[model samples]
Target chain A: MSADRPLEKLRVLVADDSPAMRGIVRAVLSGFGCDRVFEAENGLQALAVTESGGIDLVICDWKMAPCDGIELVRALRDPARSRDPFLPVIMLTAYSETARVREARDAGATEFLAKPFTAETLYQRIAAVINRPRPFVRADGFNGPDRRRLERDHSGAERRQARQS
Target chain B: MSQAKPYEIINPPNKLKAKTGSIPAVNPEAIKRAEEALEQVKSEFRNWLAEEVRKLERAHADIHANGLGGKHGEALFVVAHDLRGLGSTYEFPIVTRLAKSMCKLIETAEKRAAAPRALVDAHVGAIRAALIQNIRSDTDMVGRELVEELERQVIARVGAEG
Candidate 1:
């Protein structure tokens, strides 16, 4: 995040089934000095944008045909299939249930933002992803950010070896 | 003792920070700009919301013409779900509340078949009323009562217990 225009250089992609919601999200992203915003009507389109390259972050909706947001996240986190396996994703949708949040987190989402969101809320989520990037975790049947509750300095291979051991 | 699940953690390069590390996370000016940007598009909200409402009504109308069994019922759920997400952003938080209650009523197809049509009608009517009456929130008396009743009925219907 920058001082005057934190998201100026950031290229973000918004994926939802609704064109109206996409427009609204674009307007907000534009407000944050994010001139390089992209829109996708569904998860497949979002995948195309991400695969083509240059998208910094993704704000995805949970419901869409052919491929939904959760499916998209799973695809993105698949090391064999994804162009950027560690891409930061913020799941934004109307589903506010604790179960849904857990589902999104388990799908490899970097952060979660429920809809009817204000610019401040959106900004806070984006900032959290950037300012505190999580170390990616790869385990049996799980591939995503480290699911630890606390944040710690993970700057060396020694710490990685210790955790694996 | 059970062995710990073996996992490898990799610290991906923080490109975002590397690109813009000097900037602080909380930028008041940027937030203001974003709010202002939202305001810029506020003019089109009414028409956009009306269109969405029409979609909901059409889906509901389908439920009327055809019974609330399969596609007709699922269609209604889809529109209500979208409204549940869109109402507040469209500047009608009341619509969101009503639509949410509507969603609860028909969250699943099984629930849809069991749900009383009258309850669904109340939610649809309330959403239309919010837009037609220009009621933004439940602060207004009618809005408050309608929401409370709708939520009460939906909770009862869905076994949510309100």
Candidate 2:
């Protein structure tokens, strides 16, 4: 597990009306070594960013004046418009009410971060979401000293399994 | 009237006070840019607050039409709490003060076991008046200062009355 994985180019969108809150988020994200961070003041602006594409993740506050984080999530997760419907969204909220949290989760938020969270919490969450491996599987049963031996053994086994399936 | 408290009184466990300073952390040029950005936000925030004040007026009018206590009082408390929190955050001291007073009135109504239509209506009217005053203001700084003075007077009067 090298620290320098190829996640440097990932773009994250942060939506919060408070300049103070936005600054804290940007500082924390930068501390995590993420280079591409975009910000929006409200859900409407966040929606525009999503429409423009290339955003890997969205972290939004739930209580903007109008068209809040839930509405934002609905718009971004809309199958009709999005290139990827399961775009992981993390919602930030000051209110820690259980019912509201459940409502946000039901509205398609992948994660919820309560206000006044730490930098460590923020980084841990981003790392967990972004580091998920794509589906390309390989298995080797034999002990091989070199690459050629491992490839020969795995390829032979994979072909046999593919034929059986 | 019901025996319900209006304010949440979040003690923050460790009492995490907000940091204040005479100068900003960013460089002079960066501070200038931040201020410009903040000015834009301030304008937009003022409009948003004005819109909320109108909505608050409408909500109070509804309270008068249907009376307070029961579900209406509960809803009123929820909105008032929201106004207090956001108003304080954005430096709208008057709205926050007015909202706090309304919260107390609502709390009183709840504690009384039965809020009469007339008394409840009076409280609702006061809330509406404060909201109207908020929208007529020209700038946030002025609105905030005036509101603080108004709040002091209001709290004093409420104290004297009690």
Q: What DockQ, on C-alphas, does every prediction get? A: 0.56, 0.03
TM-score of each: 0.92, 0.44
Model 2 over residues A31-140: C-alpha lDDT tens digits?
44445889998999988888888777788987674678888877765656555555667787654456667677656676667654554455445544444311211123
TM-score, candidate 1, is 0.92
- Model 1 Cα lDDT, one tens digit per residue, B11-128: 9998777766745568788889999989988999999999999999999999999988998998899899889899999989999889888888888878988999989988899999
Best by DockQ: 1
Q: Provide all candidates' interface root-mean-square deviations.
A: 2.8, 20.2
| Candidate 1 Cα misplacement greater than 4 A, ranges | A150-165, B1-3
Compared with the true structure, what per-residue lDDT tens digits does model 2 show for residues B36-100?
44454555555555555566657666666765656665655556645654454344555555565
For candidate 1, list the clashing residue pairs, or say none.
A2-A6
Please list the residue runs of candidate 2 whose C-alpha ends up more than 4 Å from where it truly belongs after superposition.
Answer: A1-7, A131-165, B1-162
Model 1 chain A: worst 10 consecutive residues (lDDT sum): A155-164
- Model 2: docking quality category: incorrect
Model 1: DockQ vs. true structure = 0.56
Winning candidate number (lDDT)? 1
Q: Mind sharing the TM-score for model 2? A: 0.44
